[model samples]
Target: MSVRSLPSPADDPSTDIPPPPEYDGNLPFAAAGPEPARTGGERLYVAMTGAIVAGPFLALGVGGWLLWGRLIHPADLLLALGLYTITGLGVTVGFHRGLTHGSYTARRSVRIALAVAGSMSFQGDVIGWVAIHRRHHAFTDRPGDPHSPYRYGTHLRGQLRGLVHSHVGWLFRNERTPADRYAPDLLADRDIRAVSRAFPALCLLTLALPFGVGWAIGGTWTYALTALLWAGLVRIALLHHVTWSVNSLCHLIGERPFRTHRHDRATNLWPLALLSFGESWHNLHHADPTSARHGVDHGQIDPSAAVIRLLERLGWVRDVRWPTPDRIDARRA
Candidate 1:
């Protein structure tokens, strides 16, 4: 969780801006660089990444067609909503807020359960997800940030390209963050390590659960298939884009009411607030990285904070870092 690796901001006279520190940069964002030839293993990696990204999208189209045919079942929508809430909270409340930032301390069992739930979100293993996120905070919008929309420089063409890069293109690149460096604490925890290793099993379980439930509820393979499409693939696609929008759109278009590090342009994009579980309250999050509550403003909807509060009431978590008014004022832009 240590972000001390972040370099101090430097001044660039031409743009009156600071440049990001150098790191293992992606070739696509490297100015005037040629794309490197991919080895077989690298090609396989990209292929798998492509399938993961494209499959959910394909399901979305299929689901829409099924919907237009008036063949979509009520059960399918219900299951999709249920799984979306569970897995989305797992990412926002568990992986991002709790583990990544130490916003609260959960009971050992609750902690492990949350990690398992988050792993089921198809977001990557718990440890790796936390590591990459921590690295993003450490270098946010700078050279080392894994998904910065400003990677290509701030011109019209670059902005458009960076948008695509930050949204999903970065996933196709070979930008591996060292978990040992950013997530050593989780690496040391036996329970978390166990959950991390169970990632693949959890992934299969995530899909199979919907399929089995759909069959049980509707007693037909067609029901199972539709459920798998809506609840499994389509749900994942929605969550993925919502999360990626926090990386891309949140930085590009919204109110920056809170101050962040130089070159960190995280913003509070309200349109994504509910879908992203209040994670689109990006400006405040960057300003106060460890706060348990992101939507501290009045009337701002933060379902993840509500979930955390319920957990606290249930004695599953404590030492919550609820933002105070004074603390909020101090970070105002």
Candidate 2:
């Protein structure tokens, strides 16, 4: 006996459900909200900038003249360089890699060390830095991005203006990224909360530590003062620009070899490779968000990755997601 096919949903018009509402594909532009009232931190950052400018000039004019009239010591320069390198790495490896990305898990002692060292950078508390960084990744190059070099219209002058805005002007602006939305995890952590609260004390120590070291090493107040000037103030200013470059210059320039869903203009600028501790490998980072290592390829010098590897070997960190050839191939543009 011949059998007939039962009616399908498409054949039965009455049984059909209405199609879901069509998205126009145009994302609604979020309105610029009322300017936020400045916080103590905001005022502090401004005051610090002013102090950095004036302090250096005054030191050069008065202190430098006095020291020059007497004699210049080599030990002072060594102390400055040493302190700058250590503290700068603390911000880069501790704040950027370990805290912000969770590239690898560290032991309690390591975690505390990283947190304390990062705090010494005076960039802000760990939570604040991570919050703003997460927001930067979330919005990137778009209107809501914290420091997109493309904020202004695409013109020679506009891009130049935008670059300057991205580099340092964005920090001076009163807008604050919502900590609850971007960094709830950090805010909830007791250790992080305590460390963040102790930021004022950390800032004082950051400046003082260099001076103390210089005095102990050279046995002179003049040497300690010079160390403080170079290591404390100048180092911070230099690192600030290096970190900011990843936001402004990395986006606007560099090669985009990997595909991305977001309007992320991040690139791997080799020039900033060593200084940024392999953070210049931005394209791969955006491609594989959770990967522990950014500098995946051979001949790419990633000091941070080396540090992580050493930590893993020492059993201080585990579950590192190093890049595989297959994964790299998959992300290839």
Q: Which candidate leads the pack in TM-score?
A: 1
Q: 44-109 in candidate 2: lDDT tens per residue?
A: 977886674445445555545656776445665676566656666677667766776666677778
Residue 115 local lDDT, model 2? 82
Residue 93 miss distance in model 1 (angstroms): 0.7
What TM-score would each prediction reach against the true structure?
0.91, 0.82
For all candidates in order, the CA lDDT equals: 0.85, 0.71
TM-score of 1: 0.91
Error of 1 at 65 (Å): 0.8
Off by over 4 Å in 1: 1-36
Q: In lDDT terms, which candidate is top?
A: 1
* CA lDDT for candidate 1: 0.85
Q: The CA-based lDDT of model 2 is what?
A: 0.71
Instruction: Provide C-alpha RMSD values for all models, in order.
Output: 4.6, 10.8
Candidate 2 stretches with Cα past 4 Å from truth are: 1-45, 48-72
